[model samples]
Target chain A: MTELALAIENLSFAYGAKKALDDVSFDVRPGECTILLGPNGAGKSTLFSLITHLYDSRQGRIALCGFDIKKQSLKALARLGVVFQQTTLDPDLSVTQNLRYHAALHGIGRKAADNRIQEELERLNMFERRGEKVRQLNGGHRRRVEIARALLHRPSLLLLDEPTVGLDVPSRQAIVEHVHALVKEQNLAVLWATHLIDEIAADDSLVVLHRGQIKAKGKLDYVLQTTGANDAGEVFNKLTEGHKG
Target chain B: MRLLHYWRAMMGIVGRELLRFLHQRERFISALVRPLVWLFVFAAGFRAALGVAISPPYETYILYEVYITPGLIGMILLFNGMQSSLSMVYDREMGSMRMLMVCPLPRWFLLGSKLIAGTAVGVLQSYAFLGIAWAYDIQAPLMGYVWILPALVLVGMMLGALGLLLSSLIRQLENFAGVMNFVIFPLFFMSTALYPLWKIKESSEILHTLAHYNPFSQAVELIRFALYEQFNLDALIFTALSFFVFMSAAIFGYNPSKGMMVRKGGGAP
Candidate 1:
């Protein structure tokens, strides 16, 4: 059996008295992509923050490859890579510099970092543009650079928070395909958060979150069967429509 | 192995900071220009207004340019510290701070590395400023230049800590102007940057005491004495204490739970 790369148990978070993520729990096994589908302000960002330990979660536990985030944050974070919703690249720095800086932060040796950087950039077909400043790259290419940077440390689990937010249809489709290919080719566990519906493939696992609660979670077919819906659109509406407050 | 990672992390941060500094040509020019204006214009205006007495370092009367040269170096470092913190605020807004914070190292180490980077930049600016001043004939003992390096680092770290603490306290980019007006100005004016404490004492006892206690005053004094190849023990102790206090406050202010950063979460715009 494939081991779970990420595990969230009884995770709940709040902003003052307002509940953001309530009693949410889930797991993503290696070699699979779990889509976290939610509307804006549906606590998806909060969940990512808790997993990344950017925001402390008072109520539950997060584990990466069986390492508890709270007690073993260093080990947990060491094994995890993230691409936040916003682009984090420095526009003035070259692509190679950005990747090298990230690799150094992860403690990869310089020679090892160079090899990994070359490998990831080559795999993404961005090796030729490695010397170009990030500002010179188009949006899709920047996203590709971010993905390559995320994989430079060879993380077991990669969390992409709406990685295709502003891309064109082809760019979005290409990124989604690339991630799915990574999962299949390398057994990389991915927890991709997105509000876009068209990006979800039939074989991907689905977790529907609304009003700070998990309404449904499982394989797409299983979620559809349990929600009594024809497709993901109806299932999403069934889980979220009236709850908008 | 972990130690190696920490070392690399620091090098990465410092390298990025230097690269950014190099890319921004206007910043380097402005950093140098600010102090030069003070040296040539402000000092020239105050030349006849103040009288210099024989002191340990100055065996005879000195020019206002010579008197304020060390203070000018302090100013370069001071502005650079605040400027680095301004970048920190920008980095936070741009999502790069989150990138730095999630590096799997302890938070304090991350912060400490950033402070080291900022200090290194400040020291580099100081050397550049000093070179220009030396060429302009605002002379110091030949050995004074070498001896002042450590003093520059300490003063840079202190001011950088103050700036870091301020960045953690201020939430928005718009609020940073308030920091410049409130924190930076007061620290610069109330200190011995432009005038000695005795000069302030002659004007008002309260102002003298404020200048004496101001950490910036201690920082300036630390650098001022070192520029003459002398050491001020009181200034050393005071600046060191302030560094600890400010850095501790910064570390606490940057704590994710109680910090200004976490309230917005990672989806910060």
Candidate 2:
């Protein structure tokens, strides 16, 4: 009976007359990584926007650790960290400077922010690159900096929207392993949106979204069993069959 | 504790802005060069063409450069404001603005801090222009420099807020160039920045009325009076009121459900 790290109920969103997310409901629990599997046109990004309060919808309720996103946004958002699909770092600023700015936004003191910055950067093997401007970092190093920045405040829930989309195999593998370790060791809840089936771990929870609707939702094995799919890719194709994503 | 958090957030935003300003040496140079061109070249040419009647802020007959000094300061604020907003639109397009918007703070406070940060940079540019003008011998009363700080900050915030409002309305970065041509030019040319209201009135009644009421005109007069160690209540009130309206509209325009974000498909995802 632990409180859910993130809870969404009956969430719906539309752009003009076209629906983006239709009556979606889900929950993410602490210490688990929920892989939100969807294609390009699916409502994965829309759902992420709602949970992060980047967009508001009258059709649903979203709560973070028991606090409503709209009514108690400061409290709700304080418990959340995000690495958006786009690189949000100030390229002109050094890695440490970017992290410090984020930590200040969360109200972490200077000294404590520095300590956390070092710890997270070191965990991501980016401590040595702290003094370098973000523009100087390669794509992989920048992604690692972003991951480290997202964790500086130590939020219970981390929302990563396709964080590994353009990264190379090695960089992608490194980030995937690091995030899985975070879920296990820090009990951090993660709602990661991606179309890549390879990113789905065996123990991960799965939500298959296609054309703004949830087609399947459960543990990876359970979803594979229910869909009668041999693997994650087959599960995705089975759920989103005949639809142009 | 909450106050400390707010303070830290403000410092972070402002520090980042200053750092960015320092890194862009070209931006600093351009900000100064535009006003200096008007001072050294345009004012010298216009000094003979335009004769000043004793104005409230001018105790005696003054050279054209001295008369236009405050107007040029207004120029610096105006351009800096637009440039900052231009960067805002760019930031939105590039997704850095999304990072800022998602901060765990009240939306108004966050926007206000951005306005303050842009204003801080604008004020610095203004003072740098003033220092260069001092070297050029277009000096104001010593205390006028001190008095102008508050005036510059107020006017800078007002213009910066207008830029913020425009940034929210401008969905694409490409459309911003047109806005600059339309908004910045009309605001600059129609105001008292280049010519006196009376001089404008002599040419066209409608143009005169427009210049008389332009918020940029009031802003110029505000800085003009402060530079002479005087105060203009009318300009102060007008500029302050304009700031409130523009800032409120900007805050509304950034609202998730009600504003441009929802219309633009939740803005920069």
Candidate 3:
């Protein structure tokens, strides 16, 4: 079995007396593409925030590669890379410059950072547009650039919070495809948060989060087979609906 | 590599901010013009009305334009400080601000980088304003030019850190403009930026003493005296204390633990 990439236990979060994430617990294994699927306002975003150190959790613990999140956040964050829901890029900066700054923040080498940037941009087929300002790039291209930027540090655990929020179908599929390959190729652990079910593959692992609780979490096929449905989408709807009920 | 990484990150922030400033050419133009207007129009009308007198730094008759140059420099720093805070609020609204806090570097270093970047922008703007003062034939002490550089850098850092502190503590951009008018303008007006303490003393001893104790006044006088190749110990001490206060606030604002300054009014995230 691959080592546990992330372990969150008995975690609870409150937003001014309103419990956003209550009694939440889950584990994502290495080389796994575990999708945290739920509808809007179902605590998916809140959970992502807690994982990324956006806000401290009220109770329980968060561990990244066995390192306590609070005790060793730098070490935890060093191994972790996140792409936020909205575009976090500075629109005024060139694409290359944006990546360069991100690389700098992670303390990457000048020569190495330049080379990796070129390599990742080429991987996404965005090399020609490197020097263009971020405003000049289309939405799809910018999403691709963001994905490439997330991978720049070679993070072991990657988190994307509604990464395809504003993208078209093709762009969304491309991001999913790219992420799937990276997870397998690098044996990286990934927590992909989204409200869309089409993005989750049949064999991929799935965790259905509804109103701050994990109703069901297992292999996608196992979760679907238990529903006795033809496609994972139909089963996903049933699971989420039952979760709310 | 780490140091180089910091330099690159810092320069990149500066580059991005400069590019954004370029896009808003009207803003740069207007901000630059306000002080020039004060220098040429207001000072010209007030110069003769105020009459020339023997001031400590003044070797002979001095123009109002020359008297207000250092104060105007202080104004540039003041406004630039608020503008940086404005950008921080703007970025927070746009969600890009969190990207900055999430960097893998020590959070303080990342904040320090932003402070330096903003300070560089403020210093450059201050220097441009000073160039116009030079065109008015205002005589600054020759050695004062050298001293002014470090002085501006210090003032810029102090003001920038205050802005950082505000950005961290502020809940929304809506309240920032009010803070600018209430806090920043008062700090500028009540200071020695516009008129000397002796001039202010004629009106009220309370006002003169307040001006003397004002942190911003110290900043102004420090720059003012530096312009005349003089350094007051009181000004230096006050400036250092102000720096320590704002720098500590910024540190508290950015602390990953045991800090309430940054978390006071923000959303859960």
Among all candidates shown, the one with the greatest TM-score:
2
Error of 3 at A23 (Å): 2.5
| lDDT, each prediction | 0.88, 0.91, 0.80
- Which one wins by lDDT: 2 or 3? 2
Ranking by lDDT: 2, 1, 3
lDDT of 1 by residue, A27-136 (tens): 99999899999998899888888888887778988899999888899999999999988899999999999999999999988899999999999988999999999999
Q: lDDT score, residue B236, model 3?
A: 79
**Local error of candidate 3 at A15, Å?**
2.4
Between prediction 1 and prediction 3, the one with superior lDDT is 1
After best superposition, candidate 3 residue A57: deviation in angstroms? 3.0
TM-score of chain B of each: 0.96, 0.98, 0.90
lDDT of 3 by residue, A73-105 (tens): 777877788888888888878898888878877
Candidate 2 lDDT tens digits, A1-245? 98999998988889888999999998999999999999998988888788877788779899999999989888998899999888999999999999999998888999999999999999998999999999999999999998898888889899999999888999999999999999999999999999998999999999999999999998999998998989999988888884544
Candidate 2 Cα outliers beyond 4 Å, as residue runs = A242-245
What's model 2's lDDT at B160?
A: 97
lDDT string for model 3 (B1-269, tens) is 55776676777667667767777787777778988888888888898777546676567777778878888888888788878878887887777777776666566777777777778877888877877677778767677778798889888888888888887777678989788887787788888777878888999999888888888899888888777887777887888889888878876765644345224523422
- Model 3 regions more than 4 Å off: A225-245, B1-8, B11-27, B51-61, B256-269
Model 3, position A100: C-alpha lDDT score: 81
